[model samples]
Target: MIRIVILLVTLVIGSVANINAQSKYEQGMGKAFALWTENKPFEASNVFERIAEVESEEWLPHYYIAMINALNSFGVTDKEKLTLQLEKAKKHIEEAELISPNNPEIIIIKATINTAWIAYDGATYGMTLSMKNAELYKKAFELAPDNPRVVLSKAEWDMGSARYFGQSIEPYCKDIERSLELFATFKAESTMHPSWGKDRAKEVLKQCKG
Candidate 1:
């Protein structure tokens, strides 16, 4: 009887610990997502890292860290630095992918990496870079069909890339058009708590449309 009583106590303690951990996970994700939407990715990354510590099995934190690294992949000319950044980003992304191979966010991170590569390559080969950018954006869209943020992010990148087009008005105009379209689409679907993509999308649209 004493052994059975001990077993019951252990089970009760385990259940309570699991509940507490789950609550922390949920709260962490909520805060992380809020930070992400507000363009506070550095803060979000920290929160996500904390979440990973508490729940190592969760994939979102690792994925977000990879994304933050990928987004910061500009002006890094040193091959060694670029390689290290990519490897660091890949390490977290691969860890997440192993946990959830079909995750839409993981696919988006892959697309972001592709974008970073193009950003690193810059204007040396305009057409090739544009083609690669378009391919990555399209793939992200296909993988996350309902994810308006993917479309919006593509639009932002297009506008950002246009500044380097030098005397070419075509690319700039195309980017503006794409940004407007994406923002409009996101606005139409704002009911789902479109997270950080909505306001950012609208801000970009206003810039381009004006």
Candidate 2:
């Protein structure tokens, strides 16, 4: 009876420790996200990279590292700097893929990174990068057709294409609207899970309306 009681106490202590660890991780992620939402991608990326280094078993940190790099690359005007950022984004995304190969979020980020490269210098890398980006997007959709992040990525891509070609953005606006609806109802599997892209979808939806 004493042994059983001891075992029960140990289990309870272990569970509490686990809960505290998870809460700490969520707090770190919240800090990173706050920086990201404030348009501090460089700082957010650093936070994410640190998290990835410490939580080698998790894929979300690596995914966010790639995402922040990709988002920051857009504002970079220096060709050399942009190229380096894109490469870093690609490397981090690849790391994320190793951790979660079938993850829709990782797949969509891969598509986004490749698309960013094409947008950066289409004259030199357009054909191949565009093909690869489209393939990644298709794979992501196949993997998780109902995922809000996947739908948002596709909608954003369509909006970019429309703008590049000087075409109407109305169709893509509808896509964004649908994605926002999904985002509203979407439930993440865990607090540590990827639950971004909703705010981004709303931002793009506003731009499309504008």
Candidate 3:
């Protein structure tokens, strides 16, 4: 009877520890995201890198590092700086993939990284990077046909191609509209989950309408 009582107490303690860890993770992620949304990519990346190191089992931290770097690469004009950022983004995305293989969100991040690279220097990389980007997008879509984040990623890619590579925007307008609809109904599984991309989707929709 004493042994059973001790076991029950241990279980309760373990459960409490697990809940505390989750709460801490969520709070850290919230601060990191606030920095990111405030246009502080370097600060946000630092926070995310720390989270990724501490929470090695969680893939979201690594994914955010890649996503932030990729987004920042768009606004960077220095060739060397852009290359460095892209390399870091690739490394983080690769790590995230190792942690969560075949995950739809991770796949989209991989695609986004490649898309950003191609956008930065498509003239030099030519069709190879473009082909790989398309392949990754196709793989992600196959993995999660109804995922709102996937839809948003694909729509953003389409719009980017139109803006930078002179591709027609008409075909992607429907996709942008669909992504907006998807975003409206999307709900993240948890605070630490991938809850971004909706606001970006709204911006894309506006651009499409314009």
Candidate 4:
């Protein structure tokens, strides 16, 4: 009887501990995202780094860290700064892939990091990474064709290329519209899972119409 009581008590304590850990993780992510929304990306990345230290097994934190670096690397004027940022992003991308291999989102972010470098100096990186960039998006789409971000990202890339060559972007605009439709009904695996790219898609669609 005493052993049974002890076991029940232990279970309750463990459950409570798990709840507390989840609560902390949720709170930390909330703060980090708030910081990001406020345009405090470096600070947000710092928060994610702290959360990642505790949630070492989770891939989302690493994904966010890589994403922060990857997005920030865009439109950067200094080549040296861009290189350092992308290198850090690649490190986190590797970490995330280790936890969640072949993740479509991770793969897309990897492509975005390359796009950042390409955007920064197409003359320098375009010839080298451009093919790799197309391959990444292709692989990501093959993995999750219905994924709104994947569709949207690929379409955006195609549109950019078309515009570069003075070709029509209207064809890829349909993909953007399809991505929006998918976003309307899209469901994330969890609250922590990514549910992004809809707004960006909407903006792009508006551009397509305009």
- Pick by lDDT: which candidate is best? 4
Query: Candidates ranked by TM-score, best first?
Result: 4, 3, 2, 1
Tens digits of per-residue lDDT, candidate 4, 1-210, equal 223223322322222222222578888877776676566777888898898889988898888888878877766789899888899899988999998999998998898788888878889889778789889999999999999989998998899889889999999999999999999998877655677777678778987999
Writing each residue's lDDT as its tens digit, candidate 2 over 1-210 gives 223223322322222222223466666777776665555657878987888888898888888788667755654568899989889999999999998888887887788677667767788878887778778777888998789888888877766667778998888788788888998998877654666666667777878767
Better of 2 and 3 by lDDT: 2
Off by over 4 Å in 2: 1-24, 34-39, 162-173, 199-210
lDDT by candidate, in order shown:
0.59, 0.73, 0.71, 0.79
Which residue pairs of candidate 2 clash?
Answer: none
- Model 4, which residues run further than 4 Å from truth? 1-22
Report how far residue 18 has shifted in candidate 2, in Å.
20
TM-score of each model, in listed order? 0.56, 0.75, 0.78, 0.86
Ranked by lDDT from best down, the candidates are 4, 2, 3, 1
Deviation of model 4 at 92, angstroms: 0.4
- lDDT by residue (33-126, candidate 3, tens digit) is 6665555667978998998989998888888788767766774669899889889999999999999999988887787667666667777774
Question: Which stretches of model 1 miss by more than 4 angstroms?
Answer: 1-56, 77-79, 123-133, 157-194
Candidate 3 wrong stretches, greater than 4 Å: 1-22, 159-168
* Pairs clashing within candidate 3: none
For model 4 the TM-score comes to 0.86
